[model samples]
Target: MKQDIHAIEVHNLTVSYDGKPVLWDIDFNLDSGQIIGIIGPNGSGKTTSLKAIMGLLKPASGFVKIFGKSLDEVRDRVAYVPQRESVDWDFPASVLDVVLMGRSKSQNLFRRANKTDIGIALQSIEKVGLTEFKNRQISQLSGGQQQRVFIARALAQQADLYLMDEPFVGVDAATESAILELLREMKSNGKTVLIIHHDLQTVSDYFDYLVLLNTRLIAKGTPPEVLTRENLSNAYGGQLTLLSKIVDLIRQNEFPVREKGFDL
Candidate 1:
């Protein structure tokens, strides 16, 4: 397989919420067929970056290109698993029902799933070791199981590029191991996977490529190259206090006073 070209690219991307900047001039090109992790402190736009790439959130400026094309041009080739906490598991949907939703991308609007779609959904559930719970309601499963169901759904889509946000946030050790194994399998099958991860200890073990972000593009490269102490300190240090102060001001419809120009 050709590995010379980029699978995803972001150029000067910036995003904001209610006049509060979240991502700042982000730029990166990710190669295909690897487990890539994006990590940073909370409120560092980790989720926001993935959302921008998947077109779930619009960029205030700049652009995102999937396989050298706009999201609209390559939507079918991409699959996304958002942060589990962002989803309402209590919604009335069964395990199989949620997994089958992945097939919606392969069909036209208002269309029903055919037999083949059902087969694919079943296969995905089995791959994630959730076949026994396929018929169970989503809310009835544990946090790990719920995350696996979402992964199975993304798998059923059969997309070449997968973007996942914090799939390991609330899972048990066994579940985390299982998900990482599945990600490795996907990489072996020539798929590109990008995940938003938080744990600093497992960074080197789980991902071959790492993108460090703290509301901006801090560094991007192999874990060995980007996971240095200096980078980590810069990305995470003073973030909590800064975030709290900014949020407090935003709630009051105001921003911190600064000199002519200052970087947040």
Candidate 2:
């Protein structure tokens, strides 16, 4: 069969920082309309891979193609939500002001946001359940509300492929649920989403596909296959040996932590 043209394809991607290698020769293809999660221990190049894909960092030796086109050629078709902590929360901007930044690339530098842009931004904010808080300063909202604003920004971009970096890190349960629901809706609408996530326990529940990384691609498949004990060991290392064992047991029994009374 012919390869799918509408896929995110990374080929021989190697990235380094100050002569020190971070990501090494990674390759994978992800098609549209699936919620894919990238998981690994800290310093496993999860964020690095995302930065490279988003063109925030230059790869030493590789390329990423979205919808079978170079990033520059399809820049507008891609939306990225960087790590929440990466920005200054104190910036003086309202929630809607921040979300409208998503449309910046489409407008000339001197052009002001048009009515259409504002309309789209409002719609995105509503989608994330933040319509009432759109006029509020971003820093005034709770951590989860801030995260939702970022998600709304990405939605406003209206991209075909969404790349997020650890979106669930500091958010509350309600915000996490809201984000996941929006992601599922995006997938149902035929948009592909790749999230950099750290939680191993919730991996199986949140993603339809998985990418396990450790300075290199470890495994990419359905959660059942990629979250295996051996794969977790390879990705997270022997330090998580006991944790991996517990996860494996949980997988085998298909029981929730409360059901098993195991402290996670």
Candidate 3:
């Protein structure tokens, strides 16, 4: 079998803040029409990896290739939905208004958003099942709705590849399902979507490929291959031991003052 000509490629992708590293040497190839997941604990560099690929934050010593070209060289062919927390939700913009920004890259800088752009924005909003709220202020929507809006914006970009960061952070089941369904549709249409995912329990069902990361790339392969116990342990830095303790406590309601009551 041959490796697909990757839609996105990263090699020796190390990014740091000051002298401290955020992303260590990471290498992966993302092929078109796949729903790939990036999963790791907080501070495990999942989001940082996505940002490096999007060219939002420059890698301290590595390169990112989009469609086999530099990020800038193939920017319009790639779309990014940054982590929702990265933006101010209070900004003055309606849902449709924000989605229109996706088309800006294709328009003359001095030109105003046109009727055709409005149609495309509306189409994207509809795809995300947010058509009725197109005129609603973005800040007015729930967390999930805001997330869907971002996905809609990416859809409006009509890019061949999409890089999304932690999209399911606070989304409701319906909205999460809706967003995922749309992504599947995009894949069926030959678009590649790389999402930063947090829920390990759902990883098997959610993505076709997995990029398990810590400060470095722990593993990369189909979920069943890369998400093994050893790789997951490496990604969690053995914190799974402590994390499991907390989860068991939560499930048992074993508060500091309470007896240990276990769940079946």
lDDT of candidate 1 at residue 232, scale 0 to 100: 84
> When superposed on Cα atoms, how far off is each prediction in RMSD?
3.7, 11.0, 10.7
Model 3, span 1-264: residue lDDT tens: 124578888887877655456676688888777999998889878888887887778776768887788877788888999989889999999999999998888436888888998899999999988989999999999999999899899999999899899899899888788788888988898888999998988898989998988776889999889988788777785744554455345446533322235210
Clash pairs (backbone) in predicted model 2: none
lDDT score at residue 3, model 1, on the 0-100 scale? 66
Model 3 lDDT at residue 8: 80
- Report the C-alpha lDDT of model 1 over 1-264, residue by residue, as the tens digit: 566668998888878787666887789999999999999989889999999998889877778888888888888889999889888999999999999999996346788989999999999999999999999999999999999999999999999999999999889999999999999999999999999999999999999999999877778999999988888877987644665567557547755323234322
Shift of residue 154 alpha carbon in model 2, Å = 0.6
Name the better of 1 and 2 by TM-score.
1
Alpha-carbon deviation at 71 in model 3, angstroms: 1.2
TM-score of each: 0.90, 0.88, 0.87
Give lDDT for model 2: 0.85
Q: Compute the lDDT of residue 80 as modeled in candidate 1.
A: 97
Q: How much is 167 displaced in model 3, in angstroms? A: 1.1
Candidate 1 backbone overlaps, count: 0
> What are the runs in model 2 whose C-alpha is more than 4 Å off?
1-3, 239-264
Q: What is the lDDT of candidate 1?
A: 0.89
Q: Which of the two candidates, 2 or 3, achieves a greater TM-score against the reference? A: 2
